[model samples]
Target: MEQPNSPEAAADRVLDAALMHVAFDGWTDATFRAAVLDSGVDAALAKALFPRGGLDLAIAYHRRGDTLMREALAKTDLSSMRFRDRVAHAVRLRIEAVEDREAVRRGTTLFALPLHAAEGARLIWGTADAIWDALGDASRDLNWYTKRATLSGVYSSTVLYWLGDDSLGHQATWDFLDRRIEDVMRFEKVKAQLRENPLSKAILSGPLKFMENIRKPVVPDDLPGRVMDRFRPKS
Candidate 1:
């Protein structure tokens, strides 16, 4: 329900225009300028919308993919699927949401730079968080971090494999994903066994006590501090 000239709308316009140049320019300053010109948003306004230029646009594009994945997850019937299958479905939806492989390829290159590495990790974490949130994760403690952290590893590896996979229907990538998820399931099973064993649990009591205090992160919803919201990864 945003107005036509709202900042969000303008940002979307610039992003739409920038996508055309990302594959060729790899989300550089040149592409940012071209997008501003192509989007017909004032140069100053475009700058205000994306102060970091192409990097911000790339972040926006990645979040847009996450949003698309969330929407797809909402519409799909996942009730009949097993827990692991649902996780795989969500990851596949996230990857399949990509409109341009080359754009993501370029993004991978841009974010791989040491200067932008942290932002890249945040985006991946954001995606993993979105997948878990969409699937009705109720963990409020350390499990919240553990679930996303574990899935982040699975999702990142799967993406790398997917980019290189040219198999029919990317069956190879899906197979790789299943294997990775199975590995995680095995690890989780081991953790459960350790917790169930009295001796092992006693030995790890100190660390377990520390972990008990860890909780899910929360962003304040104060309206006056909304300007900083742009920097946050959308859920």
Candidate 2:
């Protein structure tokens, strides 16, 4: 009897084929194509199975890291942790997760996403930027130092710069992050002092007034009502 074509079967075939390609030939677009050929799966089916190609697989890897981070963060009291400690914890968790996932992928024929050196730098930097953005206002505090957007950006930039570093110990990136954090803390102290001064308060009032003037107009626009009407089902 012939086997039925189910979504699960199709998914398995794609994953199995992807693993095979990764194991025999390092992960690459050409390797992906070869996997399809080896599996005898049609091009259209393969495309449908993995629409975003290697990017989709890479994103899956990122999601796994995110899940681990979220779970870890949930158990910790962010309010009590020092900024550097928080950033270190998050980084360690992500690195460990990726290392574990890479090991699992290695055991299979599945090829990991083939990221060139530049592409890898971009991914790491982008991830740091994303974390900075997520931390938001909490990052501005000196106690929350390393997780600050500016500090994170520095860390990311250092990582990118270190990608090509051929020197012993790779100490440049670590030094950069440390110095950047210190500089940010110093600047924050200066800003805090200014915030406490009467002259700075007067100067800040002008910006506040400007923001007040930029408020949105309270026009009685009914565009939302029209949009809702269109979505409403007919009686």
Candidate 3:
């Protein structure tokens, strides 16, 4: 038997309907209204499902891609790959999950508004967190924040480069991704070096001590930022 209707089912229907109109309407209220009509989902239910309408639809779309990436990551074998290679591959997988560039372009425009920029940033940070969690990151300290923060920068930049890329098979975007990842690696290397150097360590002791006290945020499993809570502090 088929499953009953639910909020998730309703959201998915509206999102699927919205995608066909996104290229035309740009994820706006017009698109949302069209989706509500096209999807045949109840207006009140759809409104409850997506209180913010098109913006929430864009969020749902982004999250769907994230879910697909996680599913892909779980099936792939990464044991033989180097750590950086795994990170790069994860990023590639995340970007590759998108089926419609126009939809994302529309979403980018929607999220670029001053009112929505912070929400957009939070979504990117969430993607970075999901990538790190899927890759088995064990850090429970300040490195947690730094890793997600850096990856968010890398992912966002790669995405912008990808949006404009027209070369064969998007090889240019992959090359750009590798260079960005390499930049992150070099930055991490320098940070490690500073931590290991006695002189720099001595000079930074006060700041380092303060940093040591900064721990990762803990969120419930059902929350959007749950990835940050996957690892408890080591005993």
lDDT of 3 by residue, 30-109 (tens): 99999999999999999999898888899999999998899999999999999999999999999999999999888888
lDDT of 2 by residue, 23-138 (tens): 44534566567666776777788778667665444444454565556566656676777876566445544444444333234322232235344444454555564455444433
State the C-alpha lDDT per candidate.
Answer: 0.94, 0.53, 0.92
Off by over 4 Å in 1: 226-235
> What are the clashing pairs of model 1?
none
Q: Each model's TM-score?
A: 0.93, 0.48, 0.92
lDDT of 1 at 170: 94
Best TM-score goes to which candidate?
A: 1
For candidate 1, write residues 58-150 as lDDT tens digits.
999999999999999999999899999999999999999998888888888888999999999999999999999999999999999999999
Give lDDT: candidate 2, residue 199: 92
Candidate ordering by lDDT (highest first)? 1, 3, 2
| Angstrom error at residue 190, model 3 | 0.8
Give the C-alpha lDDT of model 1. 0.94
